[model samples]
Target chain A: MKFGIMVNEGPYTHQASDSAYNFVAAALEKGHEIYRIFFYHDGVNNGTRLTTPPQDDRNIVNRWSALAEKHEIDLVICVAAAQRRGIADADESKRNGKDADNIAPGFRISGLGQLLEASIQADRMVVFGD
Target chain B: MEEAGETKKIMYVNRKAPYGTIYALEALEVVLIGAAFEQDVYMMFLDDGVFQLKKEQDTKALGVKNFSPTYRALEMYDVEKIYVEKESMEVRGLTADDLIIPVEVKSNEEVTKMMTEMDVLLNF
Candidate 1:
């Protein structure tokens, strides 16, 4: 099955990110294809490169980035939501005159249209949030 | 149960009130955009979500744009399957008459059964 996952809350603040991660990992292990992973609202915070957790703690952002890299999954952060939360890519940073880009690896900033496309193409669209 | 090119049954479960947070408005935005896809869309008002359909909303005092009027425009998007939970309405001292648009008042059992038939379920 092809699955589209949507994360609507940031890490640490809610269990949504963790649950989505575990569900995706399990789905991949079973050889299912991930259509896309869309981050909206506070969920865009999961794509920031500035997060630095304690050495003993799990790095939520890095976990997502690594998983996305390994699986070659398209991790999309909503442009509107990302801008409001200050999650920017190189192009966005340059356009907005920001000093640097904070978008973590393996994640791309795009429009909500990507989300709608995912819903149409994927066999199932699952959302995790508050 | 979904096949390629098939129109999936998608349901947006609104469980929160409007204005207190952005969930209600954002969820509605998604619904509006999704109308273009021509899917079998359904909106369920559960818990405080029933408040979103309350009529005669005045947002001038709150200094926010009142989105209540947008509910009336949903019919234009071909999204007319709006369901309001009967228990949720009763608990809030509301009725179908209090809402801005016409909706089918469904009992909890009926709504729960309907949820099982959906291909995609989004809660806000």
Candidate 2:
């Protein structure tokens, strides 16, 4: 089945990101296709490349980026939510006159329409958040 | 990926109160954006979410946008299938007249049955 996943909370502060990662990994292992993974609300924080965890801890942002790279999944961070939380791509950074863009690799900034489109395209839509 | 112009039954489940957190407003934003796709959309206000439709909500003191009026504008966006859980409202001491817009007051069982018919359920 094609799945659309939504993450609505930030990493470390919540277990939502970890749970979603495990679910997606298991689903992919079972051969289910991922339509898209949309990051909204505080979940957009997962797309920032600036995160640095303890040496022993799991690096949440890199985990998502690596998974997307291996599976060729579209990892979309909601543009409105990302901007509000200061998670920007290089283009968005230039447009807003910011000095840097922190969006991690394998994630792209987009509109909420992508979420709606994913809902229509995917057979199932799963949301993980508080 | 699905082609354009194909419609699906989508439901937005709201369980949080407005102003206190961003869930209610976030759900509203998705509903408005989804309306443009011409899909069959439904909105359900249950638990503390029913407070979102309350009449005379003054957010000036809280310094937040009073979005209660936006409920009335939903009809213009062709999002008319709105439901309010009866038990939630009764327990909260609210009635249909207390809301800013018209909504079908449904029992939890009835709403559950409706939810099963939906293709997508987006909870906020």
Candidate 3:
């Protein structure tokens, strides 16, 4: 089955990110295709490449990036939410005339329409949040 | 109105109130977008979520935009299956008449059954 995941909270602050990560990993292990992972609200924080956690700590952003790279899944962050939270890609930074782009690898910034499309195309859309 | 694609049963569960957080408004935005998708969409108001449908919401004093009127527009978007939990309403002292839009009052058991049948469940 094709599964669409929606993460609504950032890492560390809430278990939403961890739960979504584990759910996706489990889904992949079960041989299901991930349609996409739409990050909205504080969930966009998961796409920032600037997070510098302790060497002993698990890097949530890198973990998502690695998983996306391995599975070739589309990791989408809502442009509206990302902008509000300062998570931007190279294109977005250039468009907005910002000095730097902090979007992590394997994640693309897009509109909420991607989320709607995922809901329509995927067999199930699972949302994780507070 | 024409259906955009294969129809899916989608439910938006509102468990929080409006104004205190952005969940209520953002969830409404998703519903509006779902309108264009032409899916079998349903909105359930339970717990503090019942407050979202309450009538005469005044946000002026709070200095925020009043989003209550947007609920009325859902009808135009073909999102007509709005359900309010009966027990939640009674507990909150809200009746169907207290809401801005007309809704089908349902018990928690009925709502849970409906949830089990949905293809997608979005909670806010």
DockQ of each: 0.38, 0.65, 0.52
Model 1: clashing residue pairs? none
- Name the docking class for model 1: acceptable
Q: Write the per-residue lDDT of candidate 1 for residues B11-105, one digit (tens) a residue.
A: 98999988878889888987887787778999999999999999998888888889999999999999999999999999999999999999999
Give fnat for candidates 1, 2 and onward, in order. 0.32, 0.68, 0.52
Among incorrect, acceptable, medium and high, the docking class of model 3 is medium
Which segments of candidate 2 are over 4 A away from where they belong? B1-3
TM-score of chain A of each: 0.98, 0.99, 0.98
lDDT of 1 by residue, A21-85 (tens): 99999999999999999999899999998999899989999999999999999999999888888
Could you give the C-alpha RMSD of every candidate to the true structure, in order shown? 2.7, 1.5, 1.9
Q: After superposition, how far is residue B32 of candidate 2 from its true place, in Å?
A: 0.7
TM-score of chain B of 3: 0.95
TM-score of each: 0.92, 0.97, 0.93
User: Model 3 over residues B1-124: C-alpha lDDT tens digits?
Assistant: 3344688888999989998888898889878876877788999999999999999999988999999999999999999999999999999999999999999999999999999999889888
Ranking by DockQ: 2, 3, 1
Model 3, C-alpha of B2: deviation from truth (Å): 12
Number of clashing residue pairs, candidate 1 = 0
